[model samples]
Every structure is written in C-alpha cells, then in structure tokens.
Target: MKLFRPATLVTLFTLAVSPARAWDYEGHRAVNQLALAALPTNFPAFVKTAEARERIAFLAGEPDRWRNITDDQALPHVNGPDHYLDLEQLEEFGLTPETVPALRYDFVAKLALARAQHPEKFTAIDPAKNKDHTRELVGFAPWAITEYCGKLRSEFSYLKAFQHYGGTADEIANAQQNILYTMGVMGHYVGDGSQPLHATKHHHGWVGENPHGYATNSSFHGWIDGGFFKKIGGVKVDAIVGKIRPAKIVGDPLKPEDLFRQMMAYFGDTEKLVAPLYQLEKEHKLTPENEHADEGKAFLETQLARGGQMLGDLWFSAWEQATEDRYLVTELKKRPAASAETK
Candidate 1:
C-alpha cells in the first residue's frame, strides 16, 4: 500500500488550498452518452428513448456545474471531494487499497478517529480552510458511486412495482426518467475514476521529487483532459457511443455487499492506471495534442471506453436485480392486467 510520501506535504498542502473539480463537463457527457447507448433492450423503456438519452447525457455534467458555486458555499457538503479519491490517503485511515469501509460516513468516522489518534498522519481538517478542500484528503468519489448505485437500484425496484401494477404510461415514464437521471449522475463519478489523475495525489502538477521527470506542468491536467477531447474530434459522442460494451460482472452487484466490493475494485483498477499515466508523459507519448497522438490517444480511448462499459453494466445489473424482488412478483400477481387497467 503506497502512502503519500512526507516529501509531498507542501505539494499536498498547496493542492488543499482550493476546490478543484474533475474531468470537464464535456468528458462527463461523452462517457454517459456512450453508456446510455450501450444499455440493453431490457433496460427501462424511457432510458432507451432518444430524448431521455439526450437528457441523461446532458445531466452527466451536472455535478461539475455545481462547482461553479463558490468554495465556501460548497464546502460543508464536501462537493470538491465528490469528484475524486487520492488512494494513498486511505493509509491515514488504516485502510489499504484492498480494504475499505462500506459506507461513506463510516469511512469519514474512521478517518476522524485515526486523525485523533495520530495527528501527524494528516493536515488538520480545519473548518476555516475550505471543508471541501480538507475533506478531499480522503475523497468521497468511491462512496459516491456506491451510494448512487443504491439509489438507482431503489428507483429500478419502484419502476418494477409500477410495471407490475400495470401503471399508466406517464407513471412508468416518470420512474424511468428518475432511473436515467440517477444513472447520469452515477456515470460522472465513474468517468472521474477513469481519468487516472483523479485517483492520486499527483493529480495536477507532479507531487514530490522529480526523479522520473514526469510532467510538472500545472496546465497539464486541463490541457490533457476534456480540453484535448474537445479539441480532437476522436472522442466525440458519436465516435465513442458506438464502441461501448457492458462489463461482465462476476456476481450480482445490486447486493449491498457486492456493490461495495465492486465499487472498491473499480476504484482500485483506476488507481493502478495513475502510474502509467505519468509514464506516458515520461515517455513523451502524452501531450496537449494527444488526441491525435498515437499511444496517448489509444490510452484515452481505452479509459473512456472502460468508463462507458462499466456504467452500462451497473445500469443493467440494477435492472436485473430489481426484477428479482419478491415485491415485483407479488404486485404483478395480486392484480390481473384487466382489473389493473380499469383503474
């Protein structure tokens, strides 16, 4: 379990000085549009419609849009941390990459306890400096994904109830819209994890020593992220949407235990990519014009595609698991279709 080196304290402190959001608005939309396009026919009907797909794609950018709120306004809610998790910071909570508390509050509580016991492990979580900045020391991104997944699953279950009862077209459409909107929000964090930088302390400028000659350019993050994608036509919605494929999950992710494990595993997988991202810059394969560049372009494509695929899989899994609810069967059988139609 690699921890943040003490040498990077100043760098981390500098980073903690403000609120930073992840990816860019366009990147979030691209990832979610691709995911929506890949949903199987079995998904809720509304999500498959052209209008809902467009709405979902647009809504994927909502979280970052909220960042426009001044830091003071967003801090208490920890909005800055919602976009990322610096995996090394987990060490301060006595958590390794392989282990994590299942709930967001549990993780926070544990971190608070760890800080109380060993004050030296973290910079102070002072309320004076932005709380969003302070809370970002242990980012909320992983838990955000899990929590949204649970919300989506609940929405799916309710949609199933509506379907089972032969609900009006408008009623079912409303439920479907709710699920799609939740999925869009969920996809944003999943997209963040794909960026590699979002999962590490070396996010913007390189932290610590310059032993590897990785990019230390402060502008590198924005230059390489959505800016590059928007500059190069290769990552556009049409270019990516056709390529998405759902992930093959080993188990039912809608189960509480499985959902937690799956999200952590997804985060860990993205965490591993951070080093390689630097290596790309180290090798000169990554650059501001990387959208048209060779290996760098391929890497971006792969990560974005992976994000879209995982989002689709999570959406499909929620639908599948919701169908298994005993309530669905009970509600369907309790009323005949003809009887339900009369009301």
Candidate 2:
C-alpha cells in the first residue's frame, strides 16, 4: 500500500479540524467545487488531488470567517466592504462602474472628494452605529476579485519558476499551497458577486422607494443567501455541474485593466437581475411549497454556475498567462544544489 505524502496528510488533517461557513457555507463550498469541476485537464495537476480540492472548497468561507472577529473593528471595517458593491450608490457619488478608479485607494480618495463636493447627496451616518467607519462608502467587490486574480497569477509565476529551476519538493508544495489558499478565499468574493443581492442597494430588502413593492424584510438577504436553499434541501450541484462549460481565459490574460473591466461587466449583468429576484420572492416562488419554486431554484443554480464559470476562467487565465518570475528564477539558481535535493 502506498502512503500519502506529508504535505497531503497535513492538508487533510487541517481541513478535518477547520470550522468553515459562508454564503451559508454550503453555497460557498458548492461554488468552489463547481469551479474545480470546470477546470480543464491541463490545469495544474496538484490542485486536482482530493485533498487540495477539499482545501479549496473549505476556503470558500474564509472571508466570512473574518467577519466573526467582533473584537477587531478594523478587520470588519476593511473586509466587510469587499464582499459587495452597491452599484446604485456609485451613481450618487457621480461615478459609474466604468469610471470608478481601478486602484482601491484611488477610488477611496475619489469617494471622499465626491462627498466633499456634494454633501447634500449623501446622508450623514450615525456615529453610534458607524463604529467601522464604512457606512459612508459603497462596497468594493469587483476590485477585490481583480486583485485576487493578480495574486493568483503571481503565485503561478513563482511556482513555475520554482519548479523549472532547482526548488525542493517542499518549496514547490508551499507555493502550491499559497495558490490554493488565494483561490479559495477569492472564491468567496466571486461567489458573493454571483448573488444579485450583493450587487445592489436593495441588498437587505428594497432600501428606498417602493415602486415595485419588493420585499422589505431585512431577513430577505439572509433568506436568499442560503435559507431558501436549506429549505429546498441544498443546491443540486451534480445536476448543474454538467451545465458548466470548460474553463477558458477571460479578457486579455496579460492585461489587469481588461480583467477589471470584465469584472465590472459581470457585476452589471448580475445587477440586472436584482428586480427579478425580488419579484420572485414577492410571489412566494422561492418558497418550497410554491408551484414555481423550481423557477427560483433554477435562477439561483444559474447564478452559482455563473460564479463557478467565472472563477474557473480567471484561474485558467492566470495559469495560461503567468510569465516566468525572472527575479525568483535568478534567486533560485543561486541556491546550493544540496538544498534543492534535500526535500
């Protein structure tokens, strides 16, 4: 009988003990699993292993776990906004997703300037509830996804150099681990984007005007997130797995800006569904007993598929376009031969 490698054993052990939950945990895991299913055969072989696959799936909830740290106000302040992007709020700031600055800080500066120029358009936040100081700004989901893609690309670049040069097995394993962690955490944001509620101001029910008389229950967001799925006995991943096409490169693999634009476009596509989602709920279609519950289920399954497809494309693009990390290559070449052989 063959034995599992030490690294593989460690991974399995860690996953067994880690408590994970996001997108109601199961939804997030399904998104990561779906993305894995979408990967082509030529994508990295190590990531195809069962342990690595489970690690990625488990990580889909990592971002939400950070939300659990109540003692650290700074953590939630910085991380909370990344899970969403209120497209409607962008207009109030005199910006469109197309025109929003790609750099996070630049966008922050722009929002500050916008508020200074037009205070009347903004509502003052109540300091009592604004402990995180994030209430004034719209979310940053697109930028978060794009940044993760770049990080994954960098990981691939270094891993390639390490493998091609003289890096030891442990070094290669570590680099692959980095890639898996980044991919899994990033999946959280990508999965967040797939939910139409995360892309709009109507997030926690219809925020303002009641023209459509959509759901006003604050619990509505939680319901759509995973409650409905739980009521329906969870997502049917295998049923929709076949619907996901093979992963392909998105935008220009060499251009970060192109990827940014594509992320914005993806959000725009999801935003278009915001009204329809509310309408479905208003009609009780999302309820398990509703005659059209399947319609709601189909809508959600398609969104999950969308997240999986986009994530797979980003992963494929990162791998396909990762260039040699020349600096790392030069550094690796300087290491002693024995060091490379030890692991």
Candidate 3:
C-alpha cells in the first residue's frame, strides 16, 4: 500500500531512463490502467477505498518512471553485449518455484525476487528493497516471456489460493500472507507480453557479434521489441484511446491456471518468434541517428507506444475471455430503480 513518493520519482528520473526500459514500460502503464478500470465496477465499493485509489494510481502511473532505467550498458543487444547468460538465464528463471535454495546468489531468487535475487532480475525488487518504491513497481517482463511465465505461474497461484486459504478482499489488502501476490503475477506477465521481444525469440540479437558488432547502430535490445514501430509510423495515443477495454471486461474474478493458459499463446509464439526474429533482426533496426538523437528517440517512442497499446489489448483480452461470454461489463447497462423511474 506504499505509494510512490516524489523523491523516488526524482531519483528514477535522474537515473533509470533507457531505451529498453521505455519499450517495456509503456506496456506496464497500459496494462495497469486496464486493471484500474476494473475497480469502479468489479469492486464498486472500491471507489471510496483509499487503498483502492492508491492501487489504481500505483498501477496506472507505475511504468512512466521506467524510462529512467534504460542505459547504454543494460543487457540485450541494444544496450550492450549479450555478455551474461541471457537466454539460459530465462530457463533458469523458470525454476523459481522449486525451492528457495541458496542465499543471495541463486537464480530461483531471481525468479521470485528479481533484483534481490539478481545481484537485478525483476528491475524493481532491488530498488524497492532499497526503499525506492517508485522503481519498486514491477517493470512487467523485463526478461523473455518463457522465463517470466514460469515465475508468473508461481506468483498467480494466489488467484486461486484465496479459495484454499482465506481469500477475500480484505485479505487481498492487509491480510497476513500473500495478499497482493497474484497481482504481482499479473504485473510480470503483463510486462512480458508487453515486450514484443519477450514474446519473440529474436530476444537479444541476431547471428552473433559480427553482424551488428555491438555497435550503437544495431543493438538487439531495442531491435526486437522496439524497432518495428520505429520503422512504421508512430501510433497516435489519442486515436487509439477508443480501443481500450474496461477492466471488468478485461478480467473476470481470478483463476490461476486458466489465466496462465490463456496467455500461453503469447509466450509460446514469442519463443517461436525468437529464432526467426533474431535471424532477421538485422532488418529491424531503423536508421540510427548519430546526427539526430531525436530521430532515434522518435522511432523508439512510436514503438514503445505501440507496445503499450498491445499490452492494453492483451490485458483486456484476458479479462474479456474471463467473462466467459457472459455480459461484458463495459457493454452492460444500468436501469433506474422503479421509484426513481416513476419520479
């Protein structure tokens, strides 16, 4: 329930911005907003809950600051070399649910805690622990989808955990164990699907060191998730506003496997897309702008915006399907009470 303070915002604004962050973040913002739109109707009483309002603000505005995290040295090809165990890193992240083995050095730690596990896995974990709740917000899927989904499954187990445990609205809030955990799960997958790269195999880079040679011109990071929108024209946020679906429409109550199974397609296809996208990544980067950073910025921005839009849709689809063809809340209408009607 700790909302972001201005100081945390300032710090992130000062330090975290980067291309990869930007690409992943727009997705975060889009999905969080979609989640918030659920409140007024799904938990109609939530309208007056300060905690609910806090949740809405936290989720909705959470991603904007991620722009600060992007950096010249971040992993993936765009930021720097695929220096670490990039691909396999995800496979290992998949095992997070197994055990809490190891202390500060285990990958399971990465799966569950992200950065605290990292040594920087979930992007927000480390900062959050450090008391920067602003950056504490999950950047969604900062990694590839396969790795994230594995972790997400563990996180979302709570969607149904309430049934076994004492799942209730109050428990979801201040209750002892895992109140917000499933929501955390949602945060991660929303993040994953949002990243076109996480959803695709091209993942980091194409071929190897030679093709792009780690040059600023052709890094793999932005190439997969971002470069497309750059090549295509920018998306008009205002024009696309009408496309947003309601949260209640986007989500039904909550069931773990059912929700996870629904998004299996995004992850599965992303895995398949990896190899082909990486192979063709050379063609993805828009012309770089040594002379005009704005050109690169514009390209990156448009792509990020598109990514956000896509995240929003996927989020809505999850809820849309969850409704099971019953009345879509957004499509539902209310009638006046008989007395009011007579009046």
Best candidate (score: TM-score): 2
Cα lDDT tens digits for candidate 3, 1-343: 1112232112322222221322333334444444444333543242335564345335443333332354422322221111111222344344321232212224334545654555444333354233333232212232322233333333334333433343456544432223233333335344444344554223333322345432222245544333444444543344444444443232123543333343444344344544443333334334443344344444334333433444444333432343222222222222234336788
Pairs that collide in candidate 2 are 22-25
lDDT of 3: 0.36
Give the clash count for model 3: 20
Candidate 3: where are CA atoms >4 Å away?
1-22, 37-40, 43-185, 208-218, 223-239, 246-260, 271-343
lDDT of 2: 0.83
Candidate with more favorable, higher lDDT: 2 or 3? 2
Give the Cα error of residue 172 in candidate 2, in Å: 0.4
Residue 237 in model 1: lDDT: 65
Tens digits of lDDT, candidate 1, 62-138: 77766655545644366667788888778767888667788888778887788888888666655766544455356
Off by over 4 Å in 1: 1-11, 16-18, 71-76, 125-128, 131-133, 241-243, 250-255, 288-292, 324-343
Per-prediction TM-score:
0.84, 0.90, 0.38
TM-score for candidate 1, please give it.
0.84
